[model samples]
Target: MAGHDLDRSLGLYPTMMISMGAMIGSGIFVLPALGYKKAGPAVILAYLVAAAVVLPAALSKAEMATAMPESGGTYLYIDRALGPLFGTIAGIGAWFSLVFKSSFALVGLGAYLLLFAPISQGAVVYVALALAVLVVALNVSGTKMSGQIQAVIVTLVVAGLLAYVVNAGFVADAGRYAPFTTHGGSGIITAAAFVFVSYAGVTKIASVAEEVKDPGKNLPRAMLGSMAIMTLLYIGVVGAIIGLSDPEVLKTGGPGGTASLTPMADGAGALLGGAGVLFISVIAVVALTSMANAGVLSSSRFPLAMSRDDLLPSSLQTIDARFKTPRNAVLLTGVVLLLLIAFVPVIELAKLASAFQILVFSFENMALVAFRVADVPSYEPEFKAPGYPFVQVFGFVAGIALLTQMGTVPILGAVGIILGSALVYVAYGRPRTDRTGAIGTILRARRGEEDDGIAATEPE
Candidate 1:
């Protein structure tokens, strides 16, 4: 709570767009083919399963956001609920997870560009770097500017996707539905784990809850509405791709052979010819850019929140007087994104990012259960997640189950992250921070004392 707070400039539509925009990016255009590869036509089921798994976490976050309404999103919630040690871990983990996902989008931006021009790999890296810088600059300019850009981009991307799905519906072959479970039940589950990152956008919205126009009602509505919309869109687009294209053609591998890399364009080409390819390719660029923009908007707040708690460099807490933005944190995020694009492959970064998200989501579920069990008087949320412990428990169990299916590399990466964050906290965070966490809040409430001033207040 030092430095200038973020401006409450975003409204319902912009907030909803941020959630939807972050989720609909490069993943939808490319991952469908990889999903298909893993689960065959049954990948559509994987999308549904992943969405269902994410629903509880979404509800938990929505309720938590209304209660806290702070800048850090999951990191803030976990820190307050679980205490400083776990908070440090969540702060760092959330930052890198989002950075990894943004880097994935930037690299995908480069790949989408390749569809238009024969760009060299070095050129693609530079393009991604440049785009990252531009997005950082936009965020630094102001949150309103960023929200406006998101609205425009999200509108265009959704319109294009709807068109593609409609056209695909007309041309889709009914016979392609046969042998739906090409890889069997296990493959569908595996694919669900692999693609779960697609829903991470819903949580991203919570990161900016402090900047929303109306926290009590807007936060929950935006989170739930965006998740519902994105789920339908994902299923529709994937269904269209499955119905319109041959499994053999989608599975072909080599330079430009795998539909996994360009499912939207490829499926469009089959349905509407070259014109469709060009159309979807353009929309792909817009969609990926929107994701990067929203990612930067959401991820930079982690450092800002940590800085406020004395866990990160105080410089990151500095806000631009003119634009009222966290300039230092935004620039640092851009720098890390550029380095990640240069050093890591998109596939590896994506898998690791997805794994980290599942871990953070599991923690969110735990945080909700902790709050409910404590039953603190001051911890009232305007929008409570229905089903109480049952929904939260299912989310926690399903999140961990999905993590198990992610294979060895991402699993190891998550473990390494946890260990690294623990070391950082013990060495630096423990000495400087003195905030009372959720458990302490409950104890105080039990004694008829005021909760830490973190709970949401009604607008004047």
Candidate 2:
């Protein structure tokens, strides 16, 4: 594989914040409402199912990230354990997922902006694209700046959740959430399947393994910690919404349904006063900005990966010697994200992204198994999955189950991605540099001592 450079300015704290920032975004404030629309009051069960699937997946990624301790997150895992073909496929699948999800974040941005700006309300399309552009610009500057922005965004996320928990967790009526199963069992399960996309960003933490400190420890902690935090917040926020409203009112695909968080927040206001709605609105806006912040940070690394591998034009891998950042790659990432804003909806993009990521994650789990079975002596993972193969097995099954639940469109979407990647491989997967460890290892060795230390090389 052709070698390329990336800045190492991102560290454990910043990277963890990046992952946390990404995971906490629209999934908390936005997807819950979308899930409510899909399954009504029974959405609580959906949260459980989503968390069940994603927790294991996160653990699986933690294991793989520790083993690889390099860039490309799961992409490196698959390349080493499986082969270059599978790795390339995994990379494409994951990259596509991030792209789609980032665009969906912009959709939320547009929706939230419309709520506050009358002009934005009239120009939702333009505003969504504009938010995408703005976020892209922020990320393109450099990883250090991105981390600082994410720090601010993550703070707002915490404050927003704090607001919701205080008023709704304490003051809301309980009877409104009655029976809890009002949305039907299967519907709740389906909604959970959809909401799994909320957890998608958690694995993105592993993408910058080399840039982090004490990665094996901190990455796992951040992965599991953020998941727990978000899960609790989700339960609280959704609990508040349900506690304050009749399921039938927030209900959708039925007789009387408003089917948005707005209705739920309005009900909270009725019970807790207008201050409750104000609280929800403020959090909602913060959620929008933070979600965008998350989207831009992790995604800019992809073009760097592809360029370094020669899968994309080499220009993308260029690093500014002064800043040590891949400005070209960041710009390309933004342009692609911007183009996606016009066409996709949050739920649709969420489903598609979920399917794509599930495929990559499943392979990553399998990679753990493959590496152990192959006994490749050069690699000894610092953090291994507890139960070794069993946890990975559980993760694999969970991914399959979620994919099954996605029905036809998502499944086909995943299949199409793999097939498209295969076609690309047939054409461009040459020199087999895209191969497992051979070319990448060879290139890194050749550049040893000739490098400025900015080259992305695995340490022997």
Candidate 3:
């Protein structure tokens, strides 16, 4: 596991499925209830607004990924544009956030399984851990296998959702959609902030940009395409739930603020009775498993990328000789996922994941801005993000605004991760190399000197 490169096994359709599958999980399945609680029928608008806010970051990532088409995605852009210190932070934060979110998806998988059959409480953990193993094994087997599985899962989930939306339209009572603005504009905005994390997965295709066929074209197309498709799905599904379920049943917070997380199933029960419930339950499991698989596939690349830059131990840089995958990094991420599912209350930690996603997207926009301002000659992308600096700036500001809505603990957690990564950079990464970023190139240019920094990797 030392010299092989990750195989370019993913095409446009599979890559697009990775983006869509990662996003269609617990975010739409469970959280819509909470959004409904906040904005009533107007939660549909919240989904729309959240996608609007996420669009800029998606475009920014597309532009940068086309230019650098590397495995690290957000971390790669930030490192090359801002400097290694910020890169280390972005890399570590991204890895953990993805792992946490994936672990939460596995846990959600377990919970949804319980709805299918009566499993003991302890068995849920065992079930999730088992699924984690299978997901890890799938990723370790090969990227092509993982992407293929993702394609199947996404197709099934999307087809089920589309069917549900169309069928529910026939039976759903118009009165349920009445009083749409139950909570007004402020509620819609707050719910939008809450659901912003749902769209975060759109840009994740960039993490595996190095393994995507014709990346300069496919990377942006996959990302933007998934964003558009998933946004519509979210709105449609949430609208169906709002229309099919009674208002009282859709409201969250049963006891001790524990929300009943089965609004989708309840809506299904209304649509076609017990059979509909079973169908949605099966769909939920497949969707959550898809998210977990994608998490393992993408998050593992962070360590591999960081190791290549000497931000972490070089052992992680090794690729499996047979499969050409980051075997060590995948194993390590799998271990963390198992630990999280076994002990840590990952649902609570998921808020931190959401916070980190907001931070990462903000950094992504900022990185694009930095690169464009530096005007690096080597930074030519096949597809540039339209609107340039204004889009990037709005993305950054909107990300910050969404971060504020996540509350204090999550904000502190994001800050703590940043600070700790900085410490690690100073102690471990800074001494290893004098690799400079685009900004450094600009500073050197201002001094009337030629700069020889690490902008050497040409687009794939």
Candidate 4:
């Protein structure tokens, strides 16, 4: 067998689901408490600031995506616009960032469950890892299966969020925000910087361009749709949280998104009475699952793209003969995610993921400007960033500022990873492709598998 093709079952709803699930994660509920401490009441400012920064970035991504609709998202855009080397490093970094982010998403899932199922040894990690594996299995099954699952999960997630927002009451305590700059201007800015990750999910739309139905329309629609909806929900939640209690009080409560959203349940219980927390707790679980599924859908594609380009082993590039999904890549992603949840600290990973993506986003934003200026052809994406060089540049600088605000360890670590990736590129990066080359053949086989279904057709 020599060649194959991907099953194109994903449509606009699935595309929007991918983006929605990716953005409205357990973090919004989980992180608010943390921001309460960091920025006091002013954390709201951070949320708005983060939203402002991401708006431009989203628009910029839309512009580039309209021109180049591929699986790798920014990785594909940068490589096509910049060149193989810049593209390779960017793609690797972007892929790694998602893997790390997915790892935390898994951790968040298990950790949230522990609130109700706390004391079981290895239960949390095991359960989360298992969920991740389930996602991989789903993807390997077929696009239709994956699409349905994603859409359902995303729907429940949105419903749960809207429930809390609408039911959480209107009057936010002006006192909690009294000392708006209580954490100092820098503190609120820092807290908001962290919250910025909540909006990063919108980029997931750009990551699966090849499989999206009518990418030109769906891509932009999904990007803008998810962004607008998630933003409204987020603003509502933040408003509800502040109205319910003081941010300073929340800061002292717990860690994780579940910790943050639990207050909403408490607020609801006080107003609605009895089992309120339990009701929202269930919502929390659904939200966590949604995040993991969408994440798995996105992260798996990273390795698939890398393998296709000969930067990684072609085995990872393999798709199921019948499913038209990247079987090996999905499995590999599951393995990496499991390892991260098992070993790494969640907060640290969040910071790292956020910082690294900020760097990648900065590049993407810059690429938007460069491509616009260079005037490359064939990108022809459905959406464009609007405001051209100015907005993209502004977003780029803001992202860089966030990276700096993330402090020394994360910033330095991100830089180090980029360097290490470069070194890897110097070493195993450019494996030559030839008919006799095993690696090259494997990569081609993967490409072929993506072309055909499970049954490999003999070369005609």
Query: Model 2 TM-score?
Result: 0.81
Residue 365 displacement in candidate 3 (angstroms)? 0.8
The residue pairs found clashing in candidate 1 are: none
lDDT of 3 by residue, 337-448 (tens): 8997887754454567677877888888988888888888889876678888898899899888877776687789789989999999999999996767877877788898
Best by lDDT: 3
Off-target runs (Cα >4 Å) in candidate 1 are 1-18, 119-126, 137-149, 204-225, 246-249, 252-259, 320-325, 440-460
Predicted candidate 2 versus true structure: per-residue lDDT over 1-460, tens digit per residue: 7456454556556766766676776666556666776676678778777877776667666766666656666666666566666766887787778777777666666665565555523365587788877787766665454556658867776776767666766767777665666458767877887777777777767666556566657766777777777777777777777776655555541112324434335455654456665666666667666666655666666657765676666887898786677788777777777766666544567678778877877877777776666454565666666667787888788788778877788899898988888777667765545354433443444667332221222322
**Clash number by candidate, in order:** 0, 0, 0, 21
RMSD to the hidden true structure, all candidates: 4.2, 6.3, 3.7, 7.8
Top model by TM-score, which number?
3
Worst 10 residues of 2 by lDDT: 451-460
Scored by Cα lDDT, where does model 2 land? Answer: 0.67
Worst 10 residues of 1 by lDDT: 451-460
TM-score of each: 0.86, 0.81, 0.86, 0.80
lDDT scores for all predictions?
A: 0.79, 0.67, 0.79, 0.67
TM-score of 1: 0.86
Model 3 residue runs over 4 Å out of place are 1-18, 120-126, 137-149, 178-186, 204-225, 246-257, 318-325, 342-347, 446-450, 454-460
